[model samples]
Target: MSDPVIICCAITGSVPRKSDNPAVPVTVAEQIESSHEAFEAGASIIHAHVRNDDETPTSDPDRFAALKEGLERHCPGVIVQLSTGGRSGAGRERGGMIPLRPDMCSLSVGSNNFPTRVYENPPDLVDWLSAEMAAHGVVPEIECFDLSHLFQAAALHADGRLPQRPYCQFVMGVRNAMPADRVAFDAMLTTKRHLFGDAPWCAAGIGRHQLELNEWAIAAGGHART
Candidate 1:
């Protein structure tokens, strides 16, 4: 039998704001509230990203600690997965937020242009990030945005950096990268072909294609969001 899927509700992400969805929470209290709501909605895990007063992305350990405490008290053992994808080029956000020592944290396995800006994580930085996760005993959730990125992730695994059965978050459909269609779908399949032996992966499509890619992942004998 296939393993049970882990549904991770990305409650209030860095990109989404109150204007987009009035229910999108920005404050610590509101975040807790939204998390509880998602929990009740059948999400056993949460993919979180913290925001500052101005709603900018912030890797504040205190904020993470507060969320952890609230989850422990109210949710009672729900997994909190943090995003290492910083808003700006400051690579510090990923390592800076490590004091929380979350059960799982993301590792964007490759560099890609995010809209007008580039999200850089070259080989050296990736190795460092993986080693840090290992040192802290936290599971690295490999976030792959392209086929080559998946290969890169496998390369890291081969070099004895990533875990034995690593977790993957395959992102599809972004500008300046893979498109969001059957052609993009094939690329994801290519990724699976390479990384399949090394990990259990969950997939997501950004922007308008989120739902479609998610469905593809669910149908293809992989873990997926409900």
Candidate 2:
């Protein structure tokens, strides 16, 4: 296929720490440096999450602004997608960075079981985040952690809550959430095709399933998140 694949580099996640790998970018400077490297390495998008001095995740917009500025200066046309995931913040605070007007931001349409607890994305919060994204002209990358989420995205799109063409990302291998199964992956593709037709989509696999899911998504003609 001649279609260009958009590679998204998640510089640092909320859960992983320096203690986990010693290479996780914690500070804003470190995140910028890592994002620059990823941009140079052919990643067209930077999936970012800001952390405090204590290496804990925060929803501080200032930190996101610094990271966004650095990425725009260093990476130029690279897409900056800030994480609105629950681990970074709670309630509306999770979308505090939306006003910064990043190129894109992740939006989880529904809740699912995380490793230890529920990754809650209530209807109200999801709607609020969607509105924030719309107000800021920031595109929402719908994170689908379960089959129901795909339908939820469809409903949101139908109601004009999500103005964009619903860019969904399937997240697999989380403890009590979806697993990295080939059959399930194919089913998701089928459902996406039936619901959204040829609209662009992506996938991410947590922990050990990352590379496997990347390959699977690429081979299936979908974007892969690394």
Candidate 3:
């Protein structure tokens, strides 16, 4: 088999207190600059979110469009994957950003609570978004917060809501989500069990679990970048 592909950077995510990482980009320029840095580091694909002027997250179509224009201008052929599960707005509200026609976008296969609030995604909403995305020619990278998310992914595929060659990102180590272990191999196994054999998969662990799971995902015949 050919070597698994590598995703270059996760880029600037939505959450994470500014105090934690001053490098987290919050504005248009910052997001683009960070994308450039990550692209140069050998990342051909990026998982991205748009932030407001004050460093808060927003899924504005204009903002997403701007990023698309800028990234394509500077780095052509770099796949910019937009995060549909934006932090601030309602998940459905965030869907408005789809007009930008990103090469790839996220699809949260399940929901879970994070610290203060709940991240909500349901079947109807998922089905609607998946259909809309297909019409727009956008690829969905199913985001899995836990094992159950995998089930949802299967169901979506079975129902013909999602296209084949499903792409999933196993986000382990969040508070209520799967724990991120220091053992890379263990993390890989946990992901593999849910993903089945040889599906296009990526793993991430927040906070202290980040590096461990990331490295583990990369070594375990999966691609790792952000």
Candidate 4:
């Protein structure tokens, strides 16, 4: 029997805009349509970030609700994962949509340097987000931008904060964060295995390394995110 691979599609990120590609969905309606297309193309998970009418990212729960509603109506059983990412909001505002109770949400357990600024996920905020996820029954997709984050996830799980063996996603090639290197990828896999044996995880490569990471992850018998 073939191993079943779960494909996760990030419909619209907070940083990209329609101006960047004319195809980047800025409105909720466009995002729902894009998600439906990806679902038809075999994506079982939809990772989304809501936006304002002016194309700026927002942590508006209303917008999240509308998008969640549309995705449920159009895509049925596909998992809907909302972004509690920093670009969309600051502090607790990022997790404001957690109450909407999507199947999962992105949780950054540590801070890392981005291209121009610090992607600050302070310990207190991380604790808050984790607590919120626990309260609302939202599973967290641990976004590990650096190697320390992998350990952090393990610690969180051990302490009962994460509740489950984490479904970690190694995020690579993000400017000042961990780069897209084969050695680093191998180390991540090794640590994941040590921490959670045979558990499912995923990898994501930014910019030009995206397809490469996808191939590497698949060959390694893990999951890939595009």
Candidate 5:
């Protein structure tokens, strides 16, 4: 029999406002409802980001607390992973929710280009964020937008900044970042095996490449992010 693979659902990201998609969940209550649905649909993890009443992203701790509480109550046993993505906030504000000690938090170890601007995760900030996660006992899911990020994650793990073996996530198909090329995907998988053998890994694709990346990750025996 085939083993079951974990599915992490990102219900709402920093981008994609209600104007873009009226169905996108923005408020805490709406997020909870959406998350419950995803959980019931076999998503074991919810990658969450809070938004303002006006549908703008915010790194508000209270918002995260409410979302975490609701997810725990409704989704029950689903992993809650707060995003530390740049679009939500800058510098230390991005890690504001780390103290909540969710099951996991997304950590990007390096800088990369987004669709319009640079997504920066400097070394000092990365170290600080990792340290905070370690202190709070929150496991990090390494977000590797570039191959270099994988090695950086390993280095952080080796130096004890990352207290545990992180769950690696390869992000592809961003306009100025890694493309969702089959050869690049294979190289990422090969490199992941060489660096962190048998450890859990997942793949994420932007926009139109989502399904393709999901298929590729599953066919290769890894996990998938939606």
Candidate 6:
């Protein structure tokens, strides 16, 4: 038998907006409400991204603090995993919330191409972000868009940057990044096991591939993100 699946619910991402879908929560309060619903439905982790008043992504620590407070109050033991994705901000701005000491923060160890632009996570920035997370005693959920990211995570761990057995999240089906192909997914899973050795991992897919990746990860006895 496999370990039980851990459901991570991304309440609002960096790209979507109320205009894109009014259901997308923009305010701190709205996010809490949405996250509570997900918690009730079986999501143990809330992968969060906050926004400015105009519905644009912002890496404001105050907003993240507020969201963390509300989620803890409403959802009890739900894990608050804040995103440090490049879309939220530039350079170190993306890691502003790390000091707030959420249970985990999304860490992309390598850079990759997004739909229209390069998602830059330069070595210096990655080192800074990882060091900050280490200093704050926060765990990092490595966001692996490409296979190289897994190896990078291993290197960081070996060098005393990342915590032991860092949780990983495989992101797939993003235009120029890894596709939602089963072969690639299997290779990623195999590589993760080869490098990390039974460390917990999850899979998330973009847009239409979301459900497919969720099914694949769970069926493979790993984890899923919705």
Tens digits of per-residue lDDT for model 1 on 75-98?
767887777775622665566666
lDDT of 3 by residue, 1-226 (tens): 3775676587787876467788777777777888888788778897888878777788888888888888887777899888888485675776876767888888886778876767787767888788878878899888777767877887877768887667777777778656775453465456556655667777777778777777777777666646
Clash counts for all predictions: 0, 0, 1, 0, 0, 0
Worst 10 residues of 4 by lDDT: 1-10
Candidate 6: stretches off by over 4 Å: none
User: Which segments of model 5 are wrong by more than 4 Å?
Assistant: none
lDDT of 5: 0.94
Instruction: Supply the TM-score for candidate 3.
Output: 0.89
Candidate 3's C-alpha runs over 4 A off are 1-5, 17-20, 182-196
Pairs that collide in candidate 4 are none
Worst 10 residues of 2 by lDDT: 15-24
lDDT of 4 by residue, 70-139 (tens): 9999999999999999999999999999999999999999999999999999999999999999999999
Q: Could you tell me every candidate's TM-score relative to the true structure?
A: 0.91, 0.99, 0.89, 0.98, 0.98, 0.98
**Local error of candidate 3 at residue 111 (angstroms):** 1.4
| Structure candidate 5, residue pairs in collision | none
Per-residue alpha-carbon lDDT of candidate 6 for residues 37-114, written as tens digits (9 for 90 to 100)? 999999999999999999999999999999999999999999999999999899999999999999999999999999
In the predicted model 2, the residue pairs found to clash are: none
Q: Which stretches of candidate 4 lie over 4 Å from their true place?
A: none
lDDT of each: 0.75, 0.94, 0.76, 0.94, 0.94, 0.93
Clashing pairs in 1: none
Better of 1 and 4 by TM-score: 4
Task: Tell me which of candidates 1 and 4 scores higher on lDDT.
Answer: 4
